[model samples]
Target: MCSCQQHSGTANSTSAPKDAISFRVEDMTCGHCAGTIKKAIEGQLPGSAVTADPASKLVSVVGAADFSAIKSIVTGAGYTPSPDRVS
Candidate 1:
């Protein structure tokens, strides 16, 4: 299912400017998967903050990378980017 859920938060040092976009990954299945996705995103966008909840199959990414690029990173890390959860 493809869906976009918007979240609001402050900009910390780990995140980009206030206008930076965030994406919710709904396909992450485990800690290792989360780690891989996090690494991939961070590798592409340094200091990117990724938080994953395996129980909810949800992953939140805060960085400067565009949605498409972030989706690619997740896919490259071997996880499917849920169309319903990417912002």
Candidate 2:
């Protein structure tokens, strides 16, 4: 089943996120999709770190990347980034 649960790495974690964005990516169906999103995010924002998991449908990013820019990159990469949680 596809999971749309929010990625809480930015909010619930004890350590502050290196970048301030974490949210649910509902379209990740496999490792390839996860990698594509990760590469796209990192490419768009050089020096950024991205960890995307297809199993959890979660993406955690740590960098200076803008949220809107990230969303655009994800959309451009044929994926859907739904809902921004905890800023």
Candidate 3:
């Protein structure tokens, strides 16, 4: 599942922007997986903000990102990313 959740308030130095595109990564089951996913996205998309939460299995990106690209990145990092549904 995935979602585009609207957010507000100050952008933390490391926080994804308000218009975050989120993906549900079922295979991201721990901090290490989250870090790998985050690293992969950030590495490919410089100047983008990424927040990967292992507990929630949510990977949010704030920058020039779309579902296909995000899914590709996650898949390249050996995980599965599903789009546009919450749960």
- What does candidate 3's lDDT look like per residue over 1-87, in tens digits? 222133222222333456888767776666677777888999998887788876667778878546688788888888888756332
TM match of model 2 to true structure:
0.74
Q: After superposition, how far is residue 21 of candidate 3 from its true place, in Å?
A: 0.4
Q: Between prediction 2 and prediction 3, which has the larger lDDT?
A: 2
Predicted model with the maximum lDDT: 2
Off by over 4 Å in 2: 1-19
Local error of candidate 2 at residue 80 (angstroms)? 0.6
lDDT minimum window of 10 residues, candidate 2: 7-16
Error of 2 at 34 (Å): 0.4
lDDT of 3 at 81: 84
Q: How many residue pairs clash in each candidate?
A: 3, 1, 1
lDDT of each: 0.59, 0.71, 0.69
Ranking the candidates on lDDT from highest down gives 2, 3, 1
> How well is each residue in 10-85 modelled by candidate 1, as lDDT tens digits?
2223333345554555565555555666677888888777666554565666655477787777787777877654
Candidate 1 error regions (>4 Å):
1-27
Ranking by TM-score: 3, 2, 1
lDDT of 2 at 28: 80
